[model samples]
Target chain A: MIQLTDIQRDFQVGDQQVHALRDINLQVAAGEYISIMGPSGSGKSTLLNMIGLLDQPTAGHYQLDGQDVTTLSDEQQARTRREKIGFVFQFFHLVPRLTAAQNIALPLVLAGMSEKERNKKVTQALTQMGIADRAEHRPDQLSGGQRQRVAIARATVIGPAVLLADEPTGNLDSASGIEVVKILEQLNTNGLTLLVVTHDEALGKRARRRIHMKDGLIEHDTLQNHPSLANP
Target chain B: MKTRDATRFAFDALRGYRTRTLLMLLAMSIGVASVLVLTSLGEAARRYVTGEFASLGTNLIIVLPGKSETTGGGSPNLLGGTTRDLTLNDALAVSRSSLINHMAPLIIGSAPVSVRNLQRDVMVVGTTSSLLDVRQWHLGKGQFLPETDIDRASFVTVLGSTLKQELFGAKNALGEWVRIGDRRFRVVGIMAAQGRSFDIDVENVAFVPVASAQMLFNTQSLFRILLDTRSRESIPRAIEHIRRTLRERHQGEEDVTIITQDAVLATFDKILRALTLTVAGIAAISLAVAGILIMNVMLVAVSQRTTEIGLLKALGAPRRQIIRLIMTEAALLSSMGAGLGLLVGQIGSNLIGYFYPALPLGAPWWAFVAAIGVALGTGLLFSLLPARRAAQLDPVQALARR
Candidate 1:
């Protein structure tokens, strides 16, 4: 679960001031699947970045599991991000020098897990993602869909409570994009909260909740009851 | 992150750019090599000067005609303008002072000497038979001029070892008649070889009685007075006595220079040390330039590896780790260079000694340690800029870059 109160982010571009996020307030409970839809400069990525702890807000507070993360030190923030949140980017951001297994093992490595435990966990995650055969291959050697799958495996390898994806399938083909969405949907089905920031209406509509943003503000936050969640 | 893990990562990164690392190493190696070579040259020169001084007689003093202006002016030279023409009287006075063991008035000149139609320029040293005893000049064949020869002005000469070899080959030159500047003199003995002194071949000289030399050369003045003390500890008192005696004889004028073996050797050592320092200083500049080259190369590397730095930071690597990683690369380059330089320097020093036996190149362990210290310090100093740059990069901005 995450909470945001009156979040505002400002950027200085040369002489002019730009409002990236303005007076934004939002919350999500456990196992919630939320999609943030907006045009360019609508603060979707900015909000996602804030929730991911990759950037800080110029004003207001963010509470992650009841702790005020906005006032945390850089190191503390990084530790929180490392332990509780995982990011899946549109660019796949897998270290080019590391193999899929190493990429997937990164979160655990940051947490100071033993090599043996890391290897075991990475193996299990690879098998779980159906990418076990390609575990030893580097990102450049893998296809776009395979790279995205590897990215997902890396994101969820640490068993974080929340997954934040920013245009995760933006660079993939439709079929690959659908495959990545299905994988994300499956992770969501397993009780992991998923937040996807996207411009694709059809993809955004599939989430149980859709927050449409514009001009640095959240214009709408709509929740749809999912048949799967209802049954579970 | 742990230091071991950081070192491993650094090593891997360096391995990734092997050629670049090698180039940086080569630059630093050149610096270390320059320092080693120049410093070794200095060390050799100092040893050579010290050895040369040792070869000259210790506890012995030479009283020259004119005092050096640097030591302050006193009595003017009697022979020429500045050289003293100390007589046998001055020598006798110093000898009777109880501080002296042996003393002699010496006159030095060069003339063409011929033996059996073979002629060569020979240094002619004129002194009493006591000169031979004071200098430890032993006779290999026949006998030197006796005390009676100085009283009688005997036309007898003692041939140096090389002179005998040159004129007589393997044959006997002793007791043979040799012509010196048109005067025929009998070679009564051949002096044993004394090797090189002050770069001159000491064996190429001829010795004759001082009385005969004065008559032959038409000079009544003496060029120098040589004195030997009974013991090394008595040299300073003997020198003080001679200085006081000379000052009294020359009316309190310090014109005549009293140069002891120790003073001459000390002066030689000072000159050699200064020369070594100057050469070493110049070479140190090249080393500094080499350090600069390392810094420049490391700066470029830091810039090129910016993305890598960002990736590491994003992976939860602390700023100190990034700094350590960059510094390790620099230290690795410098230390390797220093090792190679030590090898190169040792070989260079040995080669110098091999070619010139007079110049001894002794590279002590401290020199090697100094080389390493210099290299490591240079590495740390030069790496500061790049390390700071790497540490100061924004992780988010860095991660954003392709």
Candidate 2:
């Protein structure tokens, strides 16, 4: 349900043009669980961001669910992102002032959903994330794992088609990281397309299909019949 | 996003940054309050001046001997101007106009008056008995000068309340004789206490018959002629008729200046109204300053909330929605500040009114509306740049910020 052809992203760092993503091509079907792994500056995060519609490719074509999304207007891109993409950032990015439920309800509010429906969806998200009791707490009041869970809930509350996680468990402890990964795996099992970008070898190995990158180019791509439970 | 939700979001943001919000509110409210209070003060001064002019009898006219320069011709005030003394006959001739209801020839001078052992220098006003009615000054005791011919030199005089008090403290002064400029005159009336009018202390002056004042001052020219028209409609006709008669009597030369009290009042009215507007404009500058303050604070707020803005954009909020959110916050702060300022200004005005009860210190309705409108307008206008900056923020760059 995702396609990229000759996608090239370049950044200008002072006087030189740095190619963040060079001649990237990828395709993935719906319900696929994939992990992109690389060292820093390998453009793995840039690829996920491109797939999430947060960044534009300098030279390329991107198709999402049969629509050529690379040609969409900024407004259309935002609409597509709203309707078909969800993102969980390493930093969580929860509005510090909003409570857990309110943070989850943000996408619904932006979609002009009625207050009643927004509250219902927020409550369901809280329950689905297993943080129903912490819905009233702000981001600062929550632990690292709980904050990540809230961020996940916010990402999925709108029922987007693809979930993009950039270092989902990067900041969590070992126990909480395992729990968060299990939750993401459970959602993937329920047929949600999940693409995770991480530098952790063990977490990357848990995916059904894995891609490794070095210097803005994919080094390897492999599909394992039986995913290894290297860490969990 | 729904407007209500946007507003609520903006409000929450403001509440989150309470100190910044409060400082902006204070600046805005102080600006509006100054506008209201300054305008009210200006309006009060205008009203006070207007009231003082209203105290001068309506339909009253004054005839001065020398014409003001603006009326044209050789300047009557200049030494070479064809200026002529206005005599009793000229006053008598002007009195013949059918439009003129009552006329009083006036002579003003300073002279030393003594009652036995007590002596003091005092202002002396000479006018006919009709001066009492024309000036609307009431007598505290005894009677005013009898109505007689204009040239009749009556020995009767009227003592102003203060002069009477100074000359004969606890004693009756109605029948007392006082020597004024070496002439003995009997006090026929004691004027009621009049503080001051047009900078002249009426309470310290003495009044005598016009003919007697002419004889005492050794001059035939009347200082001024005060006239009261039959009605408000008769004033223009009375002025025209007096000008014609005076011109005829003064060798057909229009040397006298005839000014209606309304014209003088209108001039003062126009000046005071302009003054009020000027002060109010000066006060509105403070509102612009407040607008700049809002812009600065909003810019800081946008920077501080960079991540939150990026998150909102990521959540699918449009650029216009982001702008609307910031604009709503600024508008809310402005309206609240304007409301609070109105309250404070009214309180300040009431306090001033309480202390100085004579001045009508009410702010005009337009001032109130303009103050609020300007506050809201400036607040919105100034916040536009910051709102636009917030809207233009790249979601990727913003989210990437620590």
DockQ of each: 0.31, 0.66
TM-score of each: 0.83, 0.94
Model 1 CAPRI rating = acceptable
Which residue segments of model 1 deviate by more than 4 Å? A94-162, A170-193, A198-207, A227-232, B69-84, B96-105, B116-118, B127-154, B158-172, B188-195, B245-255, B364-369
Most accurate candidate by DockQ: 2
**For candidate 1, lDDT tens digit of each residue in B1-402?**
445555655666677678887887776676667667777778787887777666656767888887665533433343334444677677777788777877777878888889777998988888877776566556777887767733357789988898889998998776789988768899988877777666335689887888778877878778888888888999989989998887787666666778888888888888877876676667667666767777888898888877667655554555666787789888877888788777777787778779987677775455566677878888889888999899888755665666
Best by lDDT: 2
Provide the lDDT at B239 for model 2.
87
Best by TM-score: 2
iRMS, candidate 2, in Å: value is 1.1
lDDT of 2 at B14: 90
Off by over 4 Å in 2: A229-231, B69-81, B114-120, B165-172
lDDT of 2 by residue, A14-112 (tens): 999999999999999999999999999999988998998888999999999999999988778878888789999888999998899989999988888
